[model samples]
Target chain A: MHKLYMGNRQKAPGQQFITPSSHSVQFYEDPEVFLEQLAGFAGAAVGAGGCYLVLATAEHRCSLQQRLARRAIDLRMAAAGNRFIALDAREVLTTFMVEGWPNRERFFASLEPQLLRARSARLRPDAPLSAFGEMVALLWEDGHREAAVHLEQLWNELLGRHSFSLLCAYPIACFAHDSRDDLFARVCREHTEVMPTEGYTALQSDAERLRLVSTLQQEAAVVRAVVEERERAIAQRRHAEEKLWRSEEFVRRIIESGVDCVMILDPQGRLEYISPSGQQALEISNLSNFLGRSWVEFWKDEDRPRVEAALAAARAGGIGSFQGDCSTPQGTRKFWDERITPVRGNDGQVEQLIAVARDLTELRQAQQIAVQAEKLAAAGRMAATIAHEINNPLEAVTNFIYLARTTPDMPEEAARHLEVADRELTRVAQIAQKTLGFYRDTSKDKWLHVRELVEDVLLIYERKMRNKQITAEVSVDPELRIYFKQGELRQVLSNLLVNAIDACASGGRIWLRAHASTDWSEGGEDGVRFTIADNGAGMSPEVQKRIFVPFFTTKANVGTGIGLWVSKSLLEQHGGSLRFRSRQGSPSGTVMSFFVPGNANLQVHELPRSA
Target chain B: MAFLSRLLAARAPAREAFPSFSDGPPVSAVRRPHVLVVDDETLIADSVAAILNRNGYDAVARYSGLAAIEYLEKKRPDIVVTDVMLPDLDGVHVALTVRKVLPQTRVVLFSGHVSTTQLLELNSAAANSFELLSKPVHPAQLLKALQPAD
Candidate 1:
């Protein structure tokens, strides 16, 4: 039987059983919690059985016996331990307490065989824990005069079988059968009175036996059912959560595939999540470091305030946006379109701020190119009209000269008049020719002297500048040689001077300075810089930003607005850049700087020496 | 006293009489040579007047063909020098008008911008009494065109 029960612990088959005089039983939905309740109940049963015999007088013995008998009958009726505890009347007397002789000798004798049998019965069929616990408790209560020794041994056995020390509390389960008139109550009053000391401490052995036993079983059953249901619910919830995770991952992948940067920000303006596209657009490696960092940190310091304002406004409303240059580790990037939208919670408070920034730098550059082409087309039309209009009058004058010179018998005074007429016609023709030659490439690969270019440009403005009483100071390095179309250089210089004159208020000084740069890395020592400065009302930064844009002019009627645009285009084509410094409403005026690289290497191959 | 009497009775030179002829009646049977000087610009007309005076032709300048017709009805001109761009009508119309009103008149039409094809079409009329010339006209061209061939 011991081997069989040991086998049960290892993998015992059903059908093995034991016959016992009495048993205790419990039912539960969970095996573990029920085991705890069984241990507690068994502990009370030990104390209850021992105290019943020790305290029993003749007046209480009959009632106690009847109660024990009734309880045993109820255990059988409940079929509680029937599967693990066998029912046999003759063997029941030996196993249960047969209280007959004094000094408890007969009861001890009757229980000796059962005590030995209980030792082996501990190894009975692989019974449910409640039945096994009941068998152990009965053997403890009725086995011998040294029942206390057997109880300890039984406790050691059960504890050795179950790892949790809480199960060793089974012998303490003797408190279960305590009653006022019963012998166990008297014994509890003597030996187990240590129970009624404090709240839970008062739950010691026999004193609170009824409360402990009933509460233990009831709670165990209830907790077992609750645990099973909770586990089922948790499993179902995990399945639903996995499904949601896959869908969110799909959406994240789609967002990453797009070219536009998409990001989610929390209410604190920190980056909560950024799509892969956002990382690529912003040129960042890891999104983890970006998380919980302020979104404004990604923008330039000057742009942060505006970005924050835009975010705040968007969060307050449904939609808003801002435009600015964002400085990243990659480079300073210009973004034309940034859309911000707020995700609101049920309380109408913004929960998150979602932003999509589409790179508009390419689009803006394309638009600028198109506008430049259109402006050039319009300029071509105007040039054609002016050319046609001026040429007709010039041709008429030329033809009239031919006819006048050919007429015979013309007087000396008439010849002199014809000469004067021819001179005036020549002046008109020059104007027509100059107007037609505006910005045209007529003179190419010319090594024009810087002095000559300056002198020619100044000649156009000499009379006007003098009339305005504006002094001119020009310095050109006589030795500096530049290879370019002389006519184009003249046009660029003329336009610049004209613009400077127009921008300057009356009585303001204009400075035209040209010199070789001291820095060799910019080019050889031959690199020339032309700085044109004036004392007049300067333009604002906003004006400076759009100054090079086609058709953007401050002087409406007097300016076609193509002068600066053309100058810039020409300068860029020549591998140069134009930079200007200005402050609005200040007399400091504007200083425009132009850099021309004098590649002596170019002169070696292209320049023809006249000397 | 005899020299002053001689200066008052003697005939003025043709150049001195040129400025006064278009201002009033014809000095002789030529009917003041009611010249129709055509130009689109006002400055060119003023300049042309100075040239015409250095010569001996009686000239009246109008900026458009319509204005020339109005001036002609009041005073029939013996010649016309008109520009191609008039405010209402062109120099061709002025030429056609001069041919109709004064059949013996000569017309010199000037323009700086007309295409060769347009010029040919305008000069196609043999009875048009006109010759085409491009602008920036010299004073000699005006004198030569105005000189009567013997």
Candidate 2:
């Protein structure tokens, strides 16, 4: 049978200076593999009638027992026959140590009993017994290099007398750096045979194994250096990718969450990237609706030229901005304050345009209201001066009327007419004063006298009627009253009166009448109805049909076309209505009537008109 | 014109409606309290002066604050009623001038403008005793303000 020779010399029985049969093997092997190999060596020696001694930790001892059992060797029977001796290396080392240092005599005393029992159990066996020691490995792991070497030397000395083949193992982690090379060389020199690492052990010849191990070790060092550099490169790439993703995510979040419509347009004004807000501002379902579409298509036809000009400016590497009326998907008009800024490429050419559009619809409406208010302010200022001027003359005329009435010999009827004139002039003064305070919108309602309101309107028309030789007649149900906004009611009455006057020809007759009508309010309360009828050229059927429509005028530029429309609107706002009947041509006339509910302006419900 | 005078005569019985002027010197001459009324509009100034004169105060009219101040240099009026906004000097400036020249002179500033209150505030520091009236000035309120104890 071919035997394993792990070292330079084969083991011989009882040599004088050194054990010819003992081979000192220094190996770097896993503890289990070491155990199995140890078991093989130990079991072979025991089978040859040589005693086996093992000094290892209990874990390795059990592993060795299992391996020996797997090899068909009964380690327990061998121990009972005194052919095998197993001891914990730590316990054995404790017995030999004197104050943390190994004592030679103590080391000899500790092992001699185990060694003698193992040897006495066999005839100077056919072959020397094999022993395995891990105490040096334990010492090396504990960072005591000198003590580990001393233990190895002790094992070598024991080899002289015991004639045992020795196997020793240290974990590969024991000498991990170049600084431990001295200790490494000393450990190798102490052994008769130093086994290469696991990689080169399969080689057939020792010289070839040495050469291949040297080459493989050098190649492994180069491969490790290259692998470390590659790992650093991969780490750097991952870090850069993470940073780029974070920056893109940050910008994406800002653009998506922004209040304005942020969009990126190619230099040709085609939409490239439309932010979430852009889709919302344009009322599109998603960016897909706008992406790759011409941005000018979103603008109103009238606004396209301006948008094209803005895009041209932006393409020229300049900023452009415009305010425009744009419609939503539902075709409702909206105003946008849009701006396009050029994004220049490295070549200094316009690469893209960043369009940020803000919805300015409400702002535009408010600005229109401000302009209207400014116009009203100017009109009010003019009215104030005009009222003041009118009041001055009205006062003088009042005083004149007062003096005329105080005349001793004036006709009684003339005096009576002068008194009426005075009262009407006072009303004129009141109306002028009302104009001065036109901005004051009073919420208070008053019990309105319908007849008195009609009389007031008639008084305003008295001069015009007389100039046109027209006859004005009035018939009223006495004390016809309605509760409402008095000023608005007066305006409705004035509108009807003027419309009747316009319908009348020269020398025509007109009648103004009022009475309490049926319940017409939301609460079904009684209302006051007033009627104005004129015998003159009346409205055509079509004219009467569209009379209340705003801007529907028959009198060419002479009429504002808003009087009837406004009168009807105002009446509706006051919880009332204006309706009429008319016949066209000779002997034909128009009868216009309006009703004010008794409880008008008092209800909590909204009026038809917001104002 | 005759009817206007007749109308004035028609109110002869109510001559003592404002008796503050009678509380002054009671000589046989019946020395009336001289009032100076200033307004940019001649209608307002003359009408106010006429109304005051009808009530027994000897009132004169001036169209500008500077004219009122110029008139103040010659004769010391018992009261100066002026418009707050004048084409020349401001009414508050006239009041301050009155306070500087004649501390005893009473001032009444009347205007139909929103800036009247701001103008009054600017002069209220020195002329706190002056009266402010918004136009169009009612004759009764003017008469009552001229009462001695008022």
Candidate 3:
């Protein structure tokens, strides 16, 4: 039985010794030292009358042959005697490989015959048989580490059956990566003897070797600590970058979906970046055209000073805000509530400015409408008070007129004058009643003849028409009637007729037409449509578009501006509509038409009870 | 009925003899319809009463709804024409009192305030019980409204 060399030992120069049936593994860095050891092992076996079998790469085979020749071993005589056998490690690997793993049956089938021949050819039957293999190293290099380890076990199995010693060599560079300490220990555990790399093995004494190993171990510990610290710093930096990206994405999403226009400007008040919503709000399709342009250029001339002041304040690292009116790129007038704030860098210096603008056009319109409605309410109340105060005196005057007209033997001319006075007083009473109609609960609808209603409204405007020398043509069917709130309809007719009379020049003609028709636009309801047309200077297209907009008026001094808007609303309240068409030119005229439903019982209830 | 008859009989001859202003007389032989005209405006009440008197009725004038009610307490009239908006009490309240005091007497309400007239008309029971008229009422319309309903 051969004794096992579990620990590493130093050997004299050129002295080679290996016991039969020994399985040894060497992890090597330099090829020269490995080859020297290989030559010693092969030459000692051949010179001691033992057979040597070599399974190595072609390059190693050539080098081994050269080293054996220099050691004075007759490789040709050894081969002729069948005591030195050489085989390519790759070719030998395929003969026993089964799907990248060593197959025991095939391994023995291919190699046991060669082993038997080498043992029988030994000059003495008791001489040692030694085999060297590099197939496992080739497998390890090819990344088949499990196969290499399995093949090492297979070689040990072969050594148990054959009376030969096996030596396996692997390049130490293959195990240089971290976490490979277990694999290295595992490879060392598989052999009866383990040879360290040449860095340790080449030393001539144990004390020198121990000293080098102690220094290498100390340096390795320092490198391990430093690598761990660097890895931690790299991980922290990556985490911070991910958090920053998430925060940027959150802000980007908010800016993209917000309704307000948001912009970033440079210190010179030039636009640098604008949010997606900002581009849409400003009616801009391409931001490239506006980029680097002065922000104050977007405001109206009147509002430029305010915008510039706000920018200057922001540049001074303070917030500024103002409300101003401007037009968009598409030329839509807008009222904006704008604010500008400075963005500061780590050095506490103003780096950029952020401007936000909120549109307030609709809010301003609502406020104006509320004010107008309150004014109208107050006017109605004043009319009610005046009518109440005047009616009592008017009644007394009518009585006096009646008593005077019936005076005994009064002159015929004086009586006739009193009759006229009585008629005019009746008109005054009618005016008071009409004014009071605005304050009264006139929500109750009544069936009224179209002709009578038309004639009554015409009588109120008769004096104005007569003063202008304007002739009115009336064509209304006396029998045609409508169910409506009388006050609201009278107001609508009065407003339109007044507009028509105002539009007519001296001696201009006004046409008032009423016809029984079906309102196709309003679900085919039967109704009477009245058209009032005048031959006067007509409105422009821009004026026509805003004719029904509240507080939009062409008449600067006299127009209340709410007449057409209120008229339209009044018509719509009873399931009706008002529309007009106008043309400008020498034969210019305006035709304003309105429809009143024949039966508005359902709609009347929806009206407010007060007016 | 007795008080109205006494009022008409006492004022008939004196109204014809004077042809203008007449004091309250004690008694009369001929019967005439007695009318009470109430208005806060004295001219309106006096003129309306004069017109009613000229039109073959014995009429008296009061400048307030409370004064008209005070007059009604002493004597009953065939008709009471009261302005709806008055100083102390509205024509509606006076009419209600007239109905309570003299169930047989007719009540007529007139007002320049259209809203007051509307309120009376919307009061379903009052609308049925009392006749409402808009003011600046012609003397003829007022006389016609004062006429007893068929």
Score each candidate by Cα lDDT. 0.57, 0.73, 0.82
TM-score of every model versus the real structure:
0.38, 0.50, 0.72
* CAPRI accuracy category, model 1: incorrect
Best-to-worst order by DockQ is 3, 1, 2
Best by DockQ: 3
In order, the first chain's TM-score in every candidate is 0.43, 0.47, 0.67
RMSD of each: 20.0, 15.2, 8.3
| TM-score of candidate 1 against the unseen true structure | 0.38
Candidate 3 runs further than 4 Å off: A1-224, A285-289, A293-312, A442-459, A469-492, A505-538, A566-579, A585-588, A591-611, B1-30, B125-129
- Residues A1-611 of candidate 1: C-alpha lDDT, one tens digit per residue: 01100111122212112212222122223334434333333323322221111112232223333443444533332223221223232333344343421224443454344333433333233322222323223333554323433333433443344321111112344534332234433223222112221123323355466676678689878976877788789988998898899889887777888888888988778999877777877788866877999888878788888888888887886676888787555684656478889998998889999888887877886687678668766875677578667675565455445345434455878878887877767766655545554534444555667776787677667657877777778876665567666666677788888878877767778888776553355554455678888776888787889899766789898786778888888877877667888876644688887876555545532434333
Q: Give per-residue CA lDDT, model 2, range A385-502, as digits (tens).
A: 7765565555445545655565557799999998898777766665565556443323457776666777766776677788888898888754556677766676667667777777
Q: Interface RMSD for each candidate model?
A: 9.2, 4.6, 5.4
Two-chain DockQ for model 2: 0.11
Candidate 3 on A379-462: residue-level lDDT in tens?
A: 888878888888888998898787777655669999999999999998888877665655555578888777888888888888
Q: What is candidate 3's lDDT per residue for B1-150, written digit by digit as tens?
A: 453233222322344423442555433544677889898888788777777776767889998888988999999998898898887988888988998899988888888876675576566554455777888899778767766556
**Stretches of model 1 off by over 4 angstroms after superposition:** A1-369, A381-396, A402-421, A442-452, A455-474, A477-480, A485-491, A505-526, A535-552, A560-566, A569-574, A581-590, A601-611, B1-150
